[model samples]
Target: MRVVVDGMGGDNSPQAIVEGCVLAQKEYGVEIIITGPKEKIEAELAKHEYNKNAITIVDAREVISTNEAPVKALKTKKDSSLVKALDLVKNGEADAVVSAGSTGAFLAGCTLIVKRIKGISRPALAPVMPGKNGPFMIIDAGANADCKPQYLTQFAQMGKVYFENVLGVNNPTVGLVNIGEEEEKGNDLTKAAYQLLKEEDINFIGNIEPRDIPKGKVNVLVCDGFVGNTVLKMYEGVAETILSEIKTEIMGSFVTKIGGVLLTPVFKRFKKHYDYKEYGGAAFLGVNGICIKAHGSSDARALKNAIKVSKVYYDTGVLEKMKSAFAEEKDTLKIDE
Candidate 1:
């Protein structure tokens, strides 16, 4: 399978992205098509010794800036690396596309160029996070700011198929993010979503409170982008703050320093749990083509992991399963305005 990478989008640009492509090709034995300026990509490749045959470059003269408006950029910068990479997916030249560029640009590029899956109202971004049980899949992670109960219920259905096929979790339990575990705890949105999930064929495990998130209450957490983004940002902030505090305290005193050294391995283990890069990349689900969004600050290893994640998506036949899953639940999804 061919995995396309936007080589000129991130802070490190062609260098880190090229390094990632080489590594992923070596490790996963998959073909990589890098999209960027031919000379720049060639220069980056010259710096490293790799199997040159495993990598190919697709010349994309333009580079879409992060500050540019996503929808407008997609139209104006048709030859941009991000746009070209998505085009590869659209033309069937690649199995999937990976980008570390502007989130909005990637979203718009995928929507406009690669298109959305049939029967899908909107394409949602779903990222897997380390949970108590294992990896937990959270959907609409800032893809759609506003959502209806049916949208959330659809996320549950799609998320279930994703975790089962990609993450190897069978019959994954679904939870609606709410103020409390009680059915009547949340606002009209969550309440309505809760009722809809209960009526579906999914394994609805009641509601999941914010407190239960880190403790791994459920395998799938479904929420609107507003709430989902809030939870994601909060979790990131808290994880960073706690790690910083631990580092400061460890170096503040000699006694604490000794304890820190003793607990170094344990701390490393804990840090891995909070490491977003460890999960590889976030998949923009419900799209016609396989598109992955890597963290902007991602290093070569993270980029490589993102490529691997795309292959997993391709192999799992996620799109096919989604079509069947949604078809089976078609009758249950009809709602009154």
Candidate 2:
């Protein structure tokens, strides 16, 4: 499959992005089109040995910075790496678009340019995160701050499709994130969402508390972007703080240092569980075409994994499956004209 990557969009820019594309091309056997300034992208590519035929460069002169207004940037930066890369997917020239750019801009470009799938009110950002049992997905992660109960139901549906198809989870269980585990514990939104989700065809597991998220009680956690984003950030912060404290304590004294050396393998494995690079990026589900929002600070390894994630999304025919599933719900999703 062919994947278009925004080579100039990340913190590491063309270097990490170019190297990652090369790694993905070599390891995954996928054709990559890197969009950025030709000279800068090529300079990075020349540093590594890669199959020239498998990787192509598309010139995009502009870049949308993180601080810029997403909607305005998307409209004006037509030649930006992010916009051009997305255009490839919109035009069917590429199977997916991956960007380690401004998250807001990426989401805006996907909605305004690539467009959302039919019957989908707003596309949700679903990020696969490490949980106790394994990886779980959180939908609407910083995508839509305010949402209707029906929107949460749609998120649950889309999240289920992705978990099963992309993550290889069978009959994934869905849960609405709430303050308490009881069905009637949450506010109007969660309570209403619980009712909707339970009646759907998915494996609804009722309410899931934020405290139980790390336990991996459900395969898909659904919430409004406001709550989901808060959960995601808090999780990251806690993990980082714990790891940092552990390391500091491990080096506190010679005795602890010796113990630390002996426990290095265990610590390494534990740290891997929280590494964002392991999951690559979050998928902009409900978009008409595949769009992966890689972490802005993504390194080569993370970028490579993000491209790999895109390949898996494309190969699984996820967009087709989502389209069909949403088609069946179109009648229920519509409001009176």
Candidate 3:
């Protein structure tokens, strides 16, 4: 398997990206193509004494700044590193693409270059979390700001396919995100989506409110990009803040210091559950190619894991399965029409 990475996309570009590529090459035994300024990438590679043949560089002179608008960047920065890496996926030079650049830029580049699967209205970013019972997936985790009820059902179907095939979850339970558990508690979109999900043959588990997220109530949660984004960001922020406060409280005084010493192992265990690095990255699903959005602050280990996740996604035949599943639905829709 081969993966193309945007070498200049992250906060610690060239260095961290190159290092991660080296690690991934050594571990996963997959060809890695790095797209960025050739000289800079080569310099970083020189710093690391590794098997040079395992990695290749795709020279790209320009870069799209994170601040630029998504569409504008895609149109103006045609030769940017992100665009070039995506082009490799478009041309079949690489099996998957990974980047830590502007989320909007990555989305635009993926949509334009790799394109979306036919019969799917929108591609969603579906990320899995380690839940109490098993792994859970949330779609449109920050992708589509506005959504139609039909689009959400499609997200559910895509999420189900992801959980079953890639995540190894059988007949995953799907839930609509809402203000409350009752079917009539949310806005028109949620109400409609709730109805649609209940009517579907998949394992629709009624409404899942934000308060129920931590209890691991469902395996798949569906929502619009705006709502999903809010939930994810807030979840992340709350975790960070809580961790910070715990650290401060533990180290505050001598008595607390002694208590912290006694609780050090337990604290470590708790920290592992909330670590973002463990999951690697969020995937942009429904697109014709595999694209992962790594965290902006990712270290080399996280990026290496992202590459590993890409390999798993490729091995699982996720894209093809999603296409076939949605195509079947579209066929039924046409019959009804």
Highest TM-score against the true fold, candidate: 2
Arrange candidates, best lDDT first. 2, 1, 3
1-337 per-residue lDDT for model 1 (tens digits): 9999999978778788999889999999999999999999999999888887889999999999889989988888889999889989999999999998888899888888898766677778898888776778788898889998888887888889898999887899998889987888899999888888899888899998888888765888999988988888888889999999989989999999999999999999989878887777889987888999988878898899898889999998997888776667666575323
Consecutive 10-residue window with the lowest summed lDDT within model 2: 328-337
- The lDDT per prediction is 0.87, 0.92, 0.86
- Clash pairs detected, candidate 1: none
Against the true structure, candidate 1 has what lDDT? 0.87
- As a TM-score, model 3 comes out at 0.96
**TM-scores for the candidates:** 0.96, 0.98, 0.96
Task: Please name the candidate that would achieve the greatest lDDT relative to the true structure.
Answer: 2
Poorly placed runs, candidate 2 (over 4 Å): 334-337
Residue pairs clashing, model 3: none
Q: In order, how many clashes per candidate?
A: 0, 0, 0
lDDT of 2: 0.92
